[model samples]
Target: MSWRPQYRSSKFRHVYGKAATKENCFDGVPITRGVQDNNFCAVNPRFLAVVTECAGGGAFLVLSVHHTGKVDPHHPRVSGHRGNVLDVKWNPFDDYCIASCSEDATVKVWEIPPHGLLKNMTVALKELQGHSRRVGLIEWHPTAKNILFSTAYDYKVMIWNLDCPEQVIKNPVRTISHHTDVVLSMSFNVDASLMATTCKDRKIRLLEPRSGTLLQEANCKTHKASKVLILDNVNKLLTSGTSRWNDRQIALWDLDDLSVPLLEENLDGSSGFLFPFYDPDTHMLYLAGKGDGNIRYYEISSEKPYIHYLTEYRSNLPQKGMGVMPKRGLDVSSCEVFRFYKLVTIKALIEPLSMIVPRRSESYQEDIYPMTAGNKAALTADEWLTGIDRGPVLMSLKPGHPTGESDGECEKDQAYIRDRLIAKNGGKTDSNGVAGNGGTTVSNGQDFLLCSPPKTENELRVKFYKQQDEIRRLVDLLHQRDVRIKQLELEINNMKNSQQNSLEHF
Candidate 1:
């Protein structure tokens, strides 16, 4: 028989996505039915944020990632936007901080309570309102601490430095005016030194993110309705778009030379937009269509035919939007390398799919899960503004639930919390917030440490008691206030009755 070349060998070839069971899925979530091109979901290790439909104004629901099953209809929400929310992105360095853009022509940054939301939040930490038109997309900087990028219907890209310590920010730090039509998608390179965007004008352009300088514009004319993300590992740019024949296509181009694409492949003639996500550690690229149930993955290599097609994960429910859990948030014990939170609008459910590498050994698989990008940021907003570039901080997956934060960082956070609690209580505090012991250990049910989870039963009891005491005190105060108000109203009514009697006698 004539020699036939075989497919390339890859460890990730056998990796498959294992979806969660029905009981573990989020249910009764009123997902937004808006036709916006952007995904209405954003997730991190702490919380899952979903854009929900409400009557009076725009609102989105935030649930603890650990809390699955049925969500209460009266659950707390962040409903500050006056219009439909277009996109939501969590801060890489801070798990409790999230940024959202809305059709109200403003971008708002909200800080969720560390444990989770307890009541409806109607205010935001900062509000940026420079866009004359509705803001459609918002993305956080990969390496910097407080850098955010947003695009609006006004054909302008705006950058905001959220490091303001005194007051809320009203305008973006810089704005890039390049596209003639609407800007469809925007992405930053590895260290966020450069940016790539696909505009509605059917063109791809590369630019300097910090300075708002246009670097290069791709001249391809056939691919339209595109979304772009850079594979910084291979120094290549990938774009998913539609051909003139209405066929979906994916193209890979070199970063240095965007004059032409390095490779292009036509996908099926699906009308939905293709959202591309790349995991650098696994060298895997996943494309999930907007209105489809299939998630196609490929292996990107450095050799010829760089983009290698792998098997796809198929389902029956079409997804409205999707959110990816951070690499550090993955379940390393289950050999779970990647996780996607898929939003199924028809059922109003959020199902999680875990991409697993089938390994016989129960021990940690070091090869497959290397030191991936950690949750800690590499540079601050000031450092990035001063032209300093750094890659993402690296962390070992050996720690099953590594928070990607250094011990010193975690210690600093704990110390700050203890100081704040002490100030609020007007005394030195202990771990249980009582005025006693010398050593202070601020504990919570949701441990924010960088190691494996510890026993939280005691912490939960302590928290429950503290909350109970506060509620009791507040209730007593409310009763006293109500009694005084009743006494005043009775006095006023008696005076009115006496005055009416006097008037009748006259």
Candidate 2:
């Protein structure tokens, strides 16, 4: 059979256009079917790694081999975890060594080859285990490969020394358990001196990596929040996310005094649970919401906050979500675009020879001249007929024709048969009226067709009306709830006043 067209839709063509039409194509190469279930991705100075949760309960790492856009099929495959691998990072100075943390309560160090191998190119160099529960995050020390940090559900963060890979240290160098809930995210400042952890308790804490001393704490009231905390070179801290009261806000904090925010501004719309990204180079913040399916960009400045849309790309599927917007690569000479494709299930034929019939018994009787028949051979006649020596068959199937047929005669015969078949099939012609193999084309001279626009202005008007109605209904409900809350508070105050008068009388 001919190759089935897997991608022929207009959308695919629009995304990946002809090589000549660079403007029509996406900003960069589209990475189809690269990411697994994991939503987190990271890129170092040289390599790009996509960390995905595997189907077998572990994580799969697909890395780009070089700084360029080439992917090596034999990159690496580090396995040996019982849970999802949440995070993976390579040492800034050494690209060959990588650290991965898993929900299996273990962290592993892997030394990957720079090129291909006969076997799997990736191998785990060492495994570190200390957390009692699933590890949430893993980050390498900014300055040294000898140290790494990991936080887990066990309510403690651990630091490890890679100098001794075989031994398991029971106690971490420093442990922070101040958060009342699970630590969902963590990051280290550019200078490895300070580490920040955001927990489910709606608090962001800054701690010294060496001493585990809490330098400062800021309360971010958002429930189920993932905080992106950045420490500027001058020691100023910038934190942004949803508030605990369901307010969408980005707050700036002075590390010296964390009790009061230096600046706070509410975002006009709610940002769904996906974590926001902060670009230090451009001083721009990007936030995406799970419900709206839009990414909003904001500029950071000393004056009043300014936010605008850079561009919006729609998600292809529902429920399936986008992960953190990872830095495509270190080179920013041109804007890069990366597309993700989820896995698809496929069915295939396993057995190919189940329908063939055996040769007739008359042929089997002729074979009795050289083979024993009344001697009762254990092998059946059909098996014997089918079991001709494979060497001769393979040789006969090779190019240049079997020993019995001449090459010239075979070629002539094949041409004659093909012409006869074509004639019998009426010399099937395509839309161009050329007598050739079957193919379809548009009836018109045009090579392609444009998509039809929306039906009518009335339909568009209705859609807009429906959206406005939804917004109005939501506002009315919120106002009613607020009024009820105020009435309840007034009644409770009146009751307290009456109780106080009775106590005074007594």
Candidate 3:
């Protein structure tokens, strides 16, 4: 989770305090303490593992339990890079593994417990050396283990297979070169099938994952000084930063045709760079800036092709935390909001019956002798099958008829009446009882048999009951799996322990 304070209030001061003391000096210069740029940090689902950038040169891997936010500071700090750490990411599946990239043009993977000095510390398990220039970004493959991708200032992107330690680090699975300038940012599509990269050359390139082929390129019309480039997806791209001579604009490009952008809405409010976050789920874009310290949200729609400011978040004080010195008279860089997953308490799923039932009141005849209104309208066949309107619709069905029919007949009749009513009502009713069919009428004095299906409360309860039963069964299975895993871990630990004991005994 991105841990930004609610506001620049004193609350932030209480949460992350200033550096207490300087331990290691870089190049004879005491590394001043202060809040650094709010770069991307990855946190595990269980919140037990946190990978963050350090001020000096390397990244720190802190492991802690979820309940108590106590970090094991002694956990092996992976520190071999010559420059400041740029990014760190944890493997999605394995909580004990992490990948770190730095300005030193190197990407390294570390395994906890095995390589660290402390029994429970973290240590570097492998070093990946390929990029000759500063490594700006590193990301794990979304679906595969032992696979990772990295982008660097060397104008090259490399994909690595970390699974085989014996494999030479210099040999990457695939290497692609296209950008004339430094590759600023890179992202993978929802599936690992495609990859996108943005560069200072005012170009965004999309490549196939299996084969290093350039599929499409979109011109951002951005100047050479653009700070960040991000591919929105396979077709769309986003670039932002201080423009060469114009006010900062967050440009969106369409890959199909690069000559003209589908949309180039300017963000007049921000003086600094705009950090854009595109959510695939809602197709909404969120933009933030360091100059204004305001986070703005925009809805990206193809039809409108305009940016709508949904909301803005601002802080009262300068973002620079205590003891952290701002670089080159600039304010602390705004925290970049990256996407991450968090585990939430699973709530009991309550099946809603209304959704299952089809609405028929809209088709009801307003001119009928007795008209139904509000929630008392009889349910339709669609509603019965879906378990919607189980109570009121079923109860209202009997009022129109003199005798109650058998349960099975009631269900069948309800279905038949609903279909006929839909056909008779011309399937039309307005919000204010305005009939769309010019007139409403009944064929004869024969009592209308409008029977909605029985209430789905029992059915829903039964479903919940079944789900609960399934969950219990899964829990039992998980318990068994956990026991097996523990047993294997214990055996491995014992073997290692016995070996040590033998060495001492000899």
Candidate 4:
């Protein structure tokens, strides 16, 4: 059969420039499929980590990110787990430090040599053991140098401080047992002060680990375990999961109220979990999954619904795993803002797909390509452990247009929110003395006002509903405790009677 384009429109062709320009060609790393889960891919600027299942056992490959145009079978690798490794994360602050969790119910921290990728399996520098079952996820704090979090099938979350003097000989610093089921996914906010976790019980919980506070918990009515992502600004949260009708869905929630999602969109019925990547610079979010050939992206805004569908990048090859490059690692010369590393297991290929905003004018878009946080570590591991109230230093996204010029595009974007308010309120001023349309505002060579509308009856009802639910939960817990106490008392009385009878007979 002759080959033809699957898409009716040629819009996908121009997404990443020419077909050859989309993919950065490199030799594929050979891996044995079916022996391990396809969720073991991670990358730093200097190295790429992939798990390989061989006849002997599963091993982790650390390959140089720079291209040599040749594949080396004898790459530097790590093999300490008896079973397959489930997840791996490169330390955000330390390039040499990498953390991996495995099916052996343990998490291990490994350090790569300064020279380059190792040619053989190397021992881990430290092993973290606490979970009774398989550990599947591990995450490093965004700003903290040595803090790490890991979750397992045992329904436990462990927070580790690696730089502690007695860490190697002791357990994690704190253990969170709030989750009633296996935690499927987790994400930390930009400043690392808050974290969100989605679990097998179809529940999502937000936490402030430093204060031991459970910020929020809401039931997610999904068919399968879901993944939660905190948006760049930390005021919004997003989750991807399958509905009861077996349809994939993405829902956006306001951090203040989790009782209802502000927006929910149903998608295809694919079974793979969606991994979301968000770019703060352009307010773009990309969702990719296993066994899928297309990537769907959205543009987030301050308007109602919050997410606007942009477009999708389609390909014929199915992906088994995917990873994304840090924003600082992108090629700013081509106006590229995000790059995704897709793992094609069947073909044993790792493809780099770069997403760029095409422009005809030959100029560097300052607003789009503004200064971002580099790969440099702000604090040493020991220093962070001893520090107090540490906050991450992230690149602030500019508020104007991508060109950073006072053009029509910039004016339109700056006025979009103000215009929406004017339309909604019929151009009337609110009680705060700010008009919906004719008010002085804050902008670059522009004036716009933002007003907080009073809460509606619907919002009040949502809070009432949440309070009632919490009361019912607490009542049920108290009843269960009472029943257990009565049973214990009865057992104690029977034991006393038996002892008295024995003494009388003697």
Which predicted model would earn the best lDDT? 1
Identify the runs in model 4 with alpha carbons over 4 angstroms from their true place: 1-24, 32-38, 166-169, 222-225, 232-234, 361-363, 377-390, 394-506
Please estimate how well model 3 matches the true structure, expressed as its whole-model Cα lDDT.
Answer: 0.47
My TM-score estimates for the predictions, one after another, are: 0.83, 0.52, 0.51, 0.71
Ranking by lDDT: 1, 4, 2, 3
**Of candidates 3 and 2, the better by TM-score:** 2
Per-candidate Cα lDDT values, in order, are 0.83, 0.48, 0.47, 0.68
In terms of TM-score, the best-performing candidate is: 1
Candidate 4 on 1-506: residue-level lDDT in tens? 99985642222224452222323533557653743333568887656787776555557777656543445665547877787787889987666678988888888888875334424644677888788998888998777668889999899888887875553524887788899998888888776667898888888889976554788998876434378888856479898887778788888888778888887788898777677778766677888866887788877766675887778888886777777777755655577778777777776777777888776655556756656654444565545445444455444223221211124323443354444445445677667645544444322223333222226534433443443343334334555776799999999999999999999999
Lowest-sum lDDT 10-residue window in model 1 = 441-450
Candidate 2 wrongly placed segments (more than 4 Å): 1-39, 45-47, 53-55, 65-76, 116-123, 165-171, 221-225, 244-248, 266-271, 289-293, 302-329, 335-506
List, residue by residue over 153-184, the lDDT tens digit for candidate 2. Answer: 78888877666636554555557777778776
Q: Tell me model 4's lDDT, rounded to 2 decimals.
A: 0.68
* RMSD after Cα superposition, model 2: 30.6
At residue 359, what lDDT does model 2 achieve? 31
Model 3 / residue 113 / CA error / Å: 5.4
Model 3, residue 289: C-alpha shift (Å): 2.1
Q: Evaluate model 3: give its TM-score.
A: 0.51
